[model samples]
Target: MSEQAPAGWYPDGSGSERYWDGAAWTAHVRAPQPAPPAPPTDEAANVFSKLGTAVKKAASDKKASKDEALRLHEERAVAAGRLVTSGIFGTSTIEIYEHGFVRVAPGGERYAEAEKITKKTPYERLRSIAFGVPEAERAHDTEGPGSPIEGAVMQAMSGIVRGGKLLTKGTAVGIAATGVAHLASNSARKSNLVIATDKTIHTLTNQKHNGFIQVSQKEHNAVAVALVEAGNAVLGIEPVAVAQPSISAPPDAAPPAQISVAAVAVTPSLSDRIRELSELHREGILSDDEFSAAKGKLLAGL
Candidate 1:
């Protein structure tokens, strides 16, 4: 605004204090005043204490953040009806839901496979689920020795066997390959999750490179309980209490007995006899065998 301003600290209009010398802005800039320093040893101790406090506060904040995230995740899952039961098995996690379930792998190629499976499956189509270790896992073990001499002999034998007709059969080879592949891919799994619909069943293994989920007995029981509840709900089964029949004594009064009259021989009509027998049987007065015998006699007389 003027030809020249005093060569001291002045507002730069950017809210910072800057030094202007003679004609233009100078290299030197004015900064906000720093807090006064503490005593030498005390300063060092204070810095260390402050650093420790900051670290502790950071750790506490991080823990709270993780807890909040988990809480939100569970809430979302419940709202979506995608969480029936869940357990952490090693580094992986397995969730069982009413319609379907999702297993998150820890690492390796199986993780990709698990993701692919999850993408393809729609929860509505799921009907039933089962899980177990495959029986074919036995094939993963080799019987041969590692000695050089034995290796040479085995190699020679293997070459000789390769020329045989057995090699032409793809069934055995296929089975062996499949077993090996399954072993390698699912080595980390404690058990496989078998998801089934009306048409097909899918096998899911929770695995990482060397980590697998070990579901505890309590988690297993919880899963069973969830499945049972879901099945009952789906089947429209409801619980109800049955009422018991009450019998009251006839007013605690005795009726007068009729005196026996002189015998006047009278025979009931055929229809009347049949009805009387039926009534007696209905009232539990006649045993089944007695009723049959009496009915037969009465019919014969008719």
Candidate 2:
């Protein structure tokens, strides 16, 4: 909104990056950069916290054996979350696992305590996910989920109504409360991830604990990829071949006379060869044009 917005690359309302020359979008555009590889913490959940019964059951069936339940609850290291600061509310965090993801409230960064509230949504519940702001807004308009932040608030409120028994129709009350939450939920405005599940939509940002507004792009990208991977798994799909960069040959490559080698030795500098060509050119034994072109070809082999 100001003429002083620093010159840098910003999201151009699409998946690509556009250059902002401190005043307006420039002609220089580039393809979307892939999320860099970051090792995720092997954080796992031992038990469900102040989460709703529906959420708990969705992640792990209560009637199943303890071992089975524990296995189901194990959080995979696919996507690790970041801690975000909330004024007077401590820190909030989100954890993504193999099966689904969890949303922890702003009371603290940790979960599985009596007071901490959480919401878990399995990959099976996810219908679609969009990364950029414009696409996410379209999904939010057409999808059926409430805001992830509002979902937490609603879940907390559900506890109060459950004990009070002030209303005969609890489900109707939840529906009404959700409608209000949907309108009031603007957490996605600062988010880098947008998820639409069968129950609700999640718009969240991955930020460090001290900085409330700044997003951790590395962590957000990691979480975004992990979410999409999990969602794809649920839908019986696989990530694109370029998702994970590998130097090894493809599965179908033959071993005989393999030309696409992983590594090839390359000379760091060709100063010696250049010197030889320079001498030949100076001695008039080789033409200046021929020596200049031939000098570079020497490195192309060794």
Candidate 3:
């Protein structure tokens, strides 16, 4: 259209900013910059007093719209990497992206409104995975009724007492009976697999109390492990044997490169570490005291 007007920072049809170089598009690209800060306004000057109110209102609306758009964009990006599951209660999806992972509730929607949490750096996120399994919690029948014997006894007693009334009390009676059988079968464990990320803990399960639909422990573990591996792969994390730098070199040769264990340890830089700790604090990962302690430690390292 109109010969592209000798392009100089024109829209590139993609969200990212690309250089047109006045002829052909260049390889250089950058994420769109944040909207410019609102210009300072002064109403007391009286010259622009009348328009100040209108300008302020427009600015407020624009800021809100921009914020919502940013939030949605982030949510979608995080959700794109999600791992699907056949959870019963509410389908839960966990996604591990480069910066972090997001576990959204239900099968769809992708948490468009949920905040997009970011990890400080890929190294720290991968480190968490390498360390061990994350914390987990699940819904299990801690105290439903009693043992199978009690359930059977109750079932019999209820049947005898209610007799024809069993039709109306059937559901309640059935639940008790099932609980008893469930406990007796040594199936008191939870079906859900909850795994923690740097920012969030995600739960996935097929435990609907429906006998027909059950996720075996092996399957559950597979999903969790797969998620971890997939995330690690996405972040380019893998185990590698490190060759020790030669301690001795020719007299005139450059000193053998010393492989500092601490330096070799992959972690975010000091600023990134601080930012991560801040995020953890915001997400309730670290209590006030814990955050303070961890922050102090990081600072001390510096």
Candidate 4:
């Protein structure tokens, strides 16, 4: 009515087009308002929270697995039974006897359970059960043809116990006796005469006098195989050899000669002596003739 507009459109005061329905202008032609900022959905929030929890759990699991593996490796290392101390100075071996009651020291005390002595100890208390008098009683007996315990004790004391070298007959006998003592203790199931030489290891299996002497080469390659096959039979472990090389000399032999080494003072080098002499001459500390004589002497010595 005021000025009349075009039939299909209405003119807004801003000079932009407006849609006109039959009755009124419509706002469809105006720029649309930005959509309201969307709120986070419950599903999306839950997914993010779960992802964070899963990451934390995976890290915890990895840490636990690593810790468990380390514990198992330590356990296995302990069970393998490596030598703790070299039985060089004096041996502390376990003894098992024939009666099934294990005794640590012969005729001393009987242990109701072997596990009580074997388990949870830093050093293994070896048990052997064979026919022999108590270590204490054996010490008092006189050795020679008539004494059984004396003969055995003397045999055990015959070698280089520290170096593992059994270089003499006495040492060999001593090793055999020790083996028997081990067999006679509470841990031993049977006895054997075990012998180790430089080239071979021999075992007289069974308790029979002069039983089967099984032989094997003393090479590193065969140690495991031999040990496993021999088992707890006195032949299983490496036997200390008889000290066949003999620690004591024969009656006619003389004592070894002692050797002595004397230390000498180091002389100056020829070049150093010449330089010193030259400097002395230049400083008037030495005459030219004296320097020449010293230089000649040093050169000749060199």
Candidate 5:
């Protein structure tokens, strides 16, 4: 109207471009186009890729160094202080040190190419340590059938007590059952060295039956030697020996046989695993947080 405007594309308020024919708006139009994205450079991609590779390489290198260091350290560990664990989980070792210990998982001893690993725990975290039989073994020992003839004979004799009126048929049956159970449990006794820390409990058990009915005092003393070493390392004192409590006979019944596990013999000691971890830590293969985390996880398992 005031002057003929130049024919060109212009914004149409709806945000698309429209062609002005100098007299009126034209149907020719298009939505506003976005600028093309900048091309990704090889340098940027390479930076991240190289970084990842470097991280992996570093980890690999550290692992190799750690295993080498552990192997060397293990060579110097006291034979008595080096305890082995061989059971359902496989073979492992626990190397006890003055301040702490190492738990080397199965195959961890293969330095420079080990898939198994080690964890470290400070003795300061140790809560309690004792020698005893684990419930699993006790359950195993009591799983067999007892002497049926003995049970029946015992049952008959029990019925004769107190003019045959002291017990019901059910009571006689119970006594026979108890006698049978006792017979089954007389298989053998093995000891375990149980160490409990803030995070978990570690049990090192005897690999074989140390006795027929009960582990001998000599065997107990053998395990106690290892226990004393652990006690000194953790508690900084000696543990007192406590006598097993005797079960008294009931006034109306015969005295029931008791099985005591106090000072039971253990299979072996385990202290090498933590020692290996300490070796790695001292050599800077693992950092403080890494060592602590590894130790906590290892102990959390059996």
Candidate 6:
């Protein structure tokens, strides 16, 4: 019989024990247990973590840019005093007035005739005198002061009865020469006030034929304020509620799964092999028979 081995030692190395000399097991063999699989390193973890962070940052940046654009548009609209409603024209820093006058007849006789005139019998007698009898019968027998109805009819037709004048005035509120120039050019034909900016000044000067009123800075501001107030007053008839910007949902997070590096690695496929063989054949590197054989193999594998 073989001598008994030490207690801690196992035959053929299949136990977690060590051999000690003299006082303990002297010669022992034990199978080494494999090390636990290493935990992923920080660098590898950071790659995927950083990718997720970048996706979030990019979404935030896009939202910020959109918000900034919207803010700028609102600022421009407010500065320009643009109407909130569609199809309504915006107010400007200009003032416009139109005036006209109408006059009756020359003297008291026309006034008396007008006073006697009624809606039912409006100049009926005058109409009969003018169109009743034949032209020959209507002739005046006597000359001078008592001419038969000719002078009375002529008097009735003259003065403000058939003629009138229209007057228009346009004034620009606090504006520079450039502003005046713009007003003169663009609105020459129509009577209205226009606001001036650097872009419009040259056009205004070029079209100086239009009449315009140029006001001091203070007056311009006052006129602009007045116009804005007037517009607001009209708006007061039906309250205009400003629409608030819509709230946007937060962007979705990136996918949780990591993209495997192997997927993106370029490897030659069947098509690439065929193309390489075709190129080699064209360059006379392979004979037609070799090319055909290689191409057949590639197609067969496919």
Q: What 10-residue stretch in candidate 3 is worst by lDDT? A: 130-139
CA deviation > 4 Å runs, candidate 4: 1-39, 83-224, 227-302
- TM-score comparison, 3 vs 4, better candidate: 3
Per-residue accuracy of model 6 over 160-261 as CA lDDT, tens digit each? 234522112122121232342332222111111222222232011111111233211222222333433343343332222433333553468443443311
**Model 2 alpha-carbon miss at residue 56, Å:** 30
Candidate 4 lDDT, 14-82, residue by residue in tens? 756567666667775664345587976999889999999999999999999989877755564454344
TM-score of each: 0.23, 0.24, 0.32, 0.20, 0.30, 0.17
Ranking by lDDT: 5, 3, 1, 2, 4, 6
Winning model by lDDT: 5
User: Candidate 2 residues 156-263, lDDT tens each?
Assistant: 346446663222253334335445344223223223455566557665444333222121223344445455555455445544332223478789966544232111
Give all candidates' CA lDDT scores.
0.43, 0.42, 0.44, 0.35, 0.46, 0.32
Over 117-184, each residue of candidate 3 has an lDDT whose tens digit, in order, gives 23322211323333122112222433245532224334434554565223224434444555434422
Q: Which has the higher lDDT value, candidate number 2 or candidate number 5?
A: 5
lDDT of 3: 0.44
In model 5, which runs have C-alpha deviations exceeding 4 angstroms? 1-126, 133-188, 197-200, 208-221, 225-234, 241-302
- Clash list (residue pairs), candidate 1: 89-213
Residue-wise C-alpha lDDT for candidate 1, range 1-302, written one tens digit per residue? 24377676766777677777757787676765555777669778899999999999999999999898777666545543655555533233345554343333322332422233243233333465444432223233221244222232233334435662222233234324444223222221233444455445555444333222111222332343344344334434343233332365376645534442111112334664455456434533334555576567657654
TM-score, structure 1 vs. true: 0.23
Superposed by TM-score, candidate 4 places the C-alpha of residue 257 at a distance from the truth, in angstroms, of 47
Give the TM-score (vs. native) of candidate 3: 0.32
The model with the greater TM-score, 1 or 6, is: 1
Task: Write down the worst ten-residue block by lDDT for model 1.
Answer: 209-218
Better of 1 and 3 by TM-score: 3
